[model samples]
Target: MDSFDAIVVGSGFGGSVTAYRLAEAGLRVCLLERGKAYPPGSFPRSPHETAKNFWDPSSQLFGMYDLWSFSKLDALVSSGLGGGSLIYANVLIRKPETWFVNESIDGGYERWPVTREDLDPHYDSVERMLDAQPYPFDQKPYEDTPKTVAMQEAAGKLGLSWELPKLAITFARPNEAPAPGVEIPGGDDNLHHSPRSTCRLVGECDLGCNFGSKNSLDLTYLSAAQRRGADIRTFCEVRAFEPVDGGFQVSYIEHRPGQDGDPAAPPLRGAVRARRLILSAGALGTPYLLLRNRSAFPALSPALGSRFSGNGDFLGMIVKARRLQEEGGDGELVPRLLAPSYGPVVTSAMFMPDAHDEGGTGRGFYIEDAGYPEFLNWLVENNVLTMSHRVGRFLLRRAWSAATHSPKSQVGRSAADALSKGLFTATSLPMLGMGRDVPDGRVFLREGHLDLDWDLTASKPYFDRLNKTMGEVSKSLGGRYWASPLWLLNRLITVHPLGGAPMGRDRREGVVDSYGQVYGYPGLSIADGSVMPGPVGPNPSLTIAALADRSAERIIDDHRRNPAGRP
Candidate 1:
């Protein structure tokens, strides 16, 4: 029966950050992650591998993507050791100061217990640890990244606040020129023990950077935790936990590689004891676990499953922006080259002020340029009509050359056009938008599966305002707004799902306090997006990591005072 000073579950932003800090404080910490660790050159790329890249243990699949489809909307989260950072775009935007509304909005929901001032130092610390840096638009090859340029130019025309937000990517070494495929130059703390190179401009951030160009948590915080002797275990999924004398009892199952997909795989049951338990299993994960094990937590807060929000996420597309001639009106339409698949997943951001801003107006939000893996270009470029015409032209040229027996060595241009007629893919841009929407959704168990009762009932106005602004930004680029097909059905997808075990002044208000200590369970804490009282109105990753860092401090303080688990 081995006992740990602390047990951290789910190595996402919250878990990895907290685990490292706790280990650094001299605590014997054991970090548990449900999914496999994806080292450099291991992330799936080909069609066969991508098909199996999802998380479903019952079906014996242990992939990273954990997608949940509810009647209201869909939520996408990761299941790897580094958690969401495995697939996140790497933007490190802090929670806006004004946007952290303390005053209650539409009831007691979304009343944050902590303010930006409280988390500022923590934010700074996290930024340093992640090695955050803005996209090097000032550098050579990166200088002419088409979508980044288009986003900045459009925002200027619309009078919106736009800037290159710091991304968790290693485009270049410190004081070095930004060059593709250069070795990152350091190995003392590299967890993967794999060789890494600088960003190659392949636009594969979301798919998982095979070159290790992204400064993901696995390469940063988790690596530090390992160096500090933290017991980091992957493929170990926590199944149950509960309070006990002198500490808490934790139960989990070891998901061996081949057994992960076997429905009847022999259960590899295991359990441990910990003085303190920290659940960093993310918004959807933590809430689902807590709800399923509610019987064990007799005094758990009633607010456990309340205040679920999608962070006001909306996806919009601007396809084939017209390049108009300056000398004439409505003369000719040429597809502008935005190159949606050239750079990282996100390069620059545009901030739209809401009612909460300084002399602001509508619902607050952020719009960032979204990108995908370059391989997707093949999928998007397969326009039947366009390819048919190109194929016809190439065949006709070859036919004419053969009939005349002419040595037409200049058919190079014709051959090139046959492969890719790139109007749709070259000129299209996807915008990732998220903001402060009404936090009125609920999470509960239905028929033994996690279910969410959420809709746009309270957030319709916010959604309307967000979509309209996106449309204006699209028109600014001489393109038409293309709403997501899911939005047409009154549903949207959210990558930044937040708020489940929300923090509050007390148990009556939320499941945890400002320090992430569960109100009724003192030694048990939560350090993840589940603690967010409302939306962070920016990319939620940095804020989640910052808050977890703050939680680690309070945890260290508590452990020092007690020096032992509760009796």
Candidate 2:
């Protein structure tokens, strides 16, 4: 059996950062992932190819961003070596300072044990590694689609703070060809050999960066950690952990592909030994893993599954002009408009903290632009239009067939085709609102599977506030408020789920301590979204990385002080 100084599970922001830091400190680290390593060219970009993209149902159950079909809520997430980063819009954002934790708020829980001050340095470190930078260009040509630029203009009028978003995309330089694979220190052998390429701005990042410009964990930290001598094994799903004499017995399964590379194969089980265990399986996966290992830690805090919250996220579509000529535009392609599908999913954000003051009906939510891949157009045409009584079922069926069968060649032929075309020409923008959600959700183990019992009724105030702000921005941009009625009918969707297994002074109030160490276990630790004690009020990726870095440093310091295990 192979053993290491540390074993990090999941290769997302948290796991990757922890692995890199530990490996840099001369600790032998094994990073285990339940999915295959997605190379630059391996991603499917075309609409037809994207439909076939599916995550393992079993593994998806444990992922933060897994596509979930529950009796309660509709959720979507990804599973792979890079985890959700493989499919997420690379928006690197910092949580607002006020979002740390405030007990003054009604129904608020205890304050976050580790404040902004304790995480500043780690945030700085993560930003540098990911090459976080602001949008390069100031002016966009799309006038009909007023996304970030329009939001900023509206926020300025409202006397609110709006800023260009920090992105993780690498654009091409003049006279430079796309670099697909380039070597970087501490990168994986494949990624190190893979060249770095420029982004084509094909607006297909959400599907996967086939162009290789988006710096996801697989291309950044995970790759770097591999180069630093950390052993990363993919398609290895961890089942549970058992406490051993001086370490832990880690059990996992090897996944195989079915015919034509479909996800239809029996899993082969195996086990390994590790001295130190780091759980970075994300909020959903980590909790699931712990539930599976419940027998090992029966005395864990009852708070292990409490205080769960999603960074209240909402999506709305805004279209300024129905056609290029509708909004006083020249030529077939609209100019002076910022299309939501042009660049990173989120390139700018507007903060509205005061929107919730004075017993306001709303809460803090930032309105940014959301970019969708071409595949979503099909979904919009089939699902969104079919709901309209005007479109007959006979016509809708034909449209669905045409949209799905001939996606690439027959691109501009469906109901959504015209809108998508206009969008491509910068006539539309998808507005996104993210805020702190009420932490009324509960995480628990049922039949050894992680379960989430979340309700949005308590989040009515926050959503109301978000809608008001969004409406204001829409009117200012001379655009109409557009969104999937599904959101209104079934609440909203969230990509950043946080606050489970939070940190506190004792197990009575939290699962882990300020440093992310399990209260009863000496070497066991958590360095992921599971430890985020409260709503981050922003994209949780960067914050999760920062927290992991800080936790790893503390763990290393403690390990150095007491080489032998001590509680």
Candidate 3:
């Protein structure tokens, strides 16, 4: 078995940042990922192929919105070597300034342990690594997408504050790569290494970007970490950990591709040792791992799974179009003003008044532009009119249809056409509403499995506020608003799930201390969204990376001060 100075689990924003830092610091770091390391060409372009892409069903489920099957709420996450970063839209946004201050006493929610002052430098570092930049609105022609034009006009009429969104992308000189180590040049910033190819704007970022334009961790931090001598093993899932005299022992399963004549082969068991352990398996995965290891670390806080929140995120849409200039002709469908699917998942954001302050009746939603890929469009169209209970059947039928008839239907022209229409329509744009979501839920282990019990009723005011804002904005743009029926059925669906093992001054209020060190586990640490205490008022990836960076730095500093302290 291989031994390392540190073992970091998961390869998303948190684990990648920690691995890079630790390896650069001259530590032997091993990153264990439960999914494959999908190279640029490995991305599945067709719906048929992509539909088959998912993590092991025994250990986790990828597409379902519910964290646990029993939960009424909806949560969307991904599993792979780069974790959710593999399929995540690349939008990176810093948490709002006010989000750092304590809001618990104000009847709003839990407070963040570290303030803006403590996290700014880390955020700056992460931004540089991810090539974060503001969208170049002036360079591109603006189109009248439903959400973009509507919000702009609404903000203008209402005199509300707004601006073109910032994004993390490489849109520099056409057909050129980013100059080595040369920061994006002024006026012609190259945010990603793949500057040679312009964002084709295919709107399939979520399915995975075969174009290599996205600056996902696999291309950025993980690549850097590998160069620094970090050992990354993919398709290796860690089942549990046991504390040793001076380090830890990990048990995992090694999965192999199925043979041509056989069904999927059973995963083989394996074990390894490490001087330290870092859990970055994201909010969902991380908690489950810890819960499963409760016997090994009996001192873990009772709050291990308490106070779960999802930033009250929701998705909606508005579609409108102008009559073509020529009869029986398609005028250039309005180009998407916002890079819907090119840049980070969320390039822009807006803030609204807190629902709690408005007698808990207003909709507190942030409206932003989002994009959909061809496969998603196909799914939506085929299942849009079907009854809710029939969705699963519809998906299964569609899957079989594509498999038998058009093996490439997943990437078929229809998918692409729908995506183009969805993004180019003069009156179509996605509205991503995010509001304050209080952490009023808990995660627990049931029969050695993870389960979530979250309370979303308290979030009603925020949802109402978002709907009202979206309605007004849509009206201003001469369009109508439409929300996903899923929201009505499931109550909410969030891409940003945060808070479980939060940071605090002591173990009583949090599972980890201010520095992210576990309360009693000396050499164990957490560097992921699990440390957030409450909603961040924006996308959580940037904040998660910054916090992880800061934690890694602190770990290094602590080791320097006491060589024999913990390990």
Each model's lDDT: 0.89, 0.71, 0.69
Q: What is the per-residue lDDT of model 2 for residues 175-217, given as tens digits with 9 covering 90 to 100?
A: 4432323333333344535554655555677777765678888
Per residue, candidate 1 scores C-alpha lDDT tens digits across 1-567 of 668999999999999999999999999999989999999889998888888889988877789899999998899999998999989999999988888787764653479889899999999999999889999998789989999999998999888899999999988866888888888777434888988888888889998989998889999999999999999989899999988886788899998766434454555888888889999999999999999899988899999888999998999999878777652577676778898888898999999897878778866999999998766887767667867888998899899889999976777788897988667778889999999888888899999899998878788888898899889988988898998899889888999899989998888889999999998787899999999989988999999999999999999998898886533
Q: What are the runs in model 3 whose C-alpha is more than 4 Å off?
A: 57-68, 105-108, 141-150, 173-196, 259-262, 321-347, 353-365, 374-426, 564-567
Among all candidates shown, the one with the greatest TM-score:
1
TM-score for each candidate, following the candidate numbering: 0.95, 0.83, 0.81
Candidate 2 C-alpha error for residue 195, in Å: 2.3
Return whichever of 1 and 2 wins on TM-score: 1
lDDT of 3 by residue, 259-320 (tens): 44345567889888877899998888888889888899999987788768887787877656
Which residue pairs in model 1 clash with each other? 60-260, 60-261
Q: Give the candidates in order of TM-score, highest first.
A: 1, 2, 3
Q: How many collisions between residues are there in candidate 2? A: 23
